[model samples]
Target: MRDFIGRAMMTLYFTVCATLKSGAMIVALRDPTWSWARGISVAADVAALGFLVLIVATTVARLPPVKTAQGIEPRLSALIGCFATVTLIAVPGVQTLPQLELVADLITIVGFTLCIWCLWWLGRSFSITAQARRLVTAGPYQLVRHPLYACEAVVLFGIVLRNPTWAVVAIGAIVICFQCRRIINEEKVLRSAFPEYDAYARATPILIPSISTLRELVFPGAR
Candidate 1:
């Protein structure tokens, strides 16, 4: 029952973020007087919404109903923190929208693509509950250890660049910190549950992609 509730809460959280971001995007795109910041916001919003949908659908489809927990779970707190940080980013700040630049557009496009790739990599392996069921070494995992989070970081960095406000930057930083904490905690759990996880960690980079690692993953015999 606890696990079920946690999963439900997580779903609700992602749904709310997705809805908020989508609404913000619609507003940005439809407004004739949209500023540069507004346009960037619109891109970020769309990317976030699309990512959330992918994450939620993939997660719920593979994971079984979570059993209810008896007490507060650390993962729940981390989840809430993540939600809060993302919400802060979605909210508009005091800065006026900057003028649109070609470089910014290219960055945003790349960021969006990375997020999509991250979601694709995380397919069927995503979960909200505080349990480590399996060590996924296929797909994106074969490329990087935490591709989803890495992609998100890239996307958020692009968003920050588009709207170089202190608020947005701070929010992005907080979100990164939250993700890092979650990653650390999750790694601890995974290491304990799966003995081979440590070995995998030794060979794989956590977030950043390396050409050599990519080669090794793609061509096992080359390494």
Candidate 2:
């Protein structure tokens, strides 16, 4: 029953995030500028939506017991809310003259690459609230415990580079803080569910890459 609720809520969350990002991408594509930034933005959205769909589609029966779940308490709180579009929605659509648009485009490609592949590594174990179906130690996981959030940070930074506004900066800061809280929330449960998680974390950086682990590749040897 708890797993049922967890699956449903996570499905809803990822679906909504993908839907919003799809809408934003549609708007960006309509631009006649034929801009490379718009193209990269579209690719990013596609990768993100594809990954989100994969996460939802892969949720199956006979899964491992979830020792921890988020949003199962049925209480509304700021901590429970996820900033799904902190990377995509804050600056939806291409600006007529966005700052650092090219650099942002490149970053978008790099980020979504990390994100999509990390999801691949995570496979069916992925959840919005850190449900531990499996403890992945291969691929990007070897470099960072929360590879998804790490990729997201880079993606959000790219958006900030393009927007470069006080408003965007504030939103990014808030989003980062929210993510930090989420990490703590997730780790608490992970520690209980997976005994080796502490050692894995000790060996892996939280969001940043350790040179030893990261030398595997900038985006991981996988796609």
Candidate 3:
């Protein structure tokens, strides 16, 4: 069937991507040039690798969606946003202050860890395209509607910081634009599929969490 083929292809795509990236990172970590910066970078790579493996696993195990966007645009947006940052790997690293690179590595490590947490909550609902599998409103989703994408944005920003080049910045900006489009398309699909999604969106911020939102999440009685 066509649907079965699509799912198989998707699984293959994610599997190849995760395997290659993880292998490269593992090899890099094995290099004998150990330093504080390298250690931090290794941590970031490990977190990133974990996230990638999770993505492949979730993609293979995710539930069937109730509704899927019915256009080429949504698929294109999702694919672009998902893979855009990969170009940064080819960009030459710039010579920067060791402290600055270390800060960027720390930021990526934190972002990737949060991303993994978000993905854990997403679980069976994960999809590369705009599709509504189930209404997830727990964990990081309680604070922000698209916490996964927000965390990914953090990782992308950290990568840009690590490789401060005009091409990197331009690609980052383009990727962000596509990511925004992907978010919009996903919201539309979710709202169409779930009647309660509108109310949830109203209560939760889209990407950024405010101070009041943090307080409410911490102390539910405050609301």
Candidate 4:
């Protein structure tokens, strides 16, 4: 019952966010002066929508039943709310001049790449909610405990960069705060569920890359 509610809430939240993003893209397209810019924005928005759909499908198919916690984390809820609000505001009001648009495009490319890598890693260890799944400690997981969230942050940052509105920047900040809280909760859950998680956490960096660890993972022959 708890999992059901959580899933429903999450779906509703995403739906709202998607609608806002689509609306924003439409507004951007309607601007006659920025034809090329509008086109690029539309393309990026479409790509983001596609990626979001894939994420929802994959998460639904792969994740285990979400245990009903005491309450929804306030920070997480704030993040979603702020993101939706910003998307709606940004769509109609934010001006994406050519120069800013180009930067956003590059960031989007990098963000997409990171997202894809994280998704691939997650796919390998993914399991259906109905089935029991074990902790994943390989691939991206070997580097950071919350690589997916980090990738998500990158994506959000790219969106903000593309838009660069005060509203969007604020939304991104809220998202970061929410992600931090979510990570803490996830770590707690992992520690409780997996005996070896503590050792893994000790060895792996949370978000940033550790040079020594990266060296070890990438070039085992080096040391």
Indicate which candidate wins on TM-score: 3
RMSD of each: 4.0, 4.5, 2.1, 4.6
- Per-candidate Cα lDDT values, in order, are 0.65, 0.67, 0.84, 0.62
User: Any idea what lDDT model 2 has?
Assistant: 0.67
The sequence of per-residue lDDT tens digits that candidate 1 reaches over residues 68-174 is: 22235546646654675556645653344344443444565677677677667656556643456667876777767777677667667666766677777777777
lDDT of 3 by residue, 12-128 (tens): 766676676677677777798889888887787777778877877887788888999988999999888777764453233467889889998899889889999999999999988
Model 2: per-residue Cα lDDT over 126-180, one tens digit each: 6655456777888888878888888878877776776678777787787777677
By lDDT, the better pick of 2 and 4 is 2
Q: Which ten residues in a row have the lowest lDDT in candidate 4?
A: 124-133
Stretches > 4 Å off in candidate 4:
12-43, 66-69, 72-93, 124-133, 216-220
Worst 10 residues of 3 by lDDT: 85-94
Runs of candidate 3 with Cα error greater than 4 angstroms are 86-95, 219-223
RMSD of 2: 4.5
Candidate 1 global lDDT: 0.65
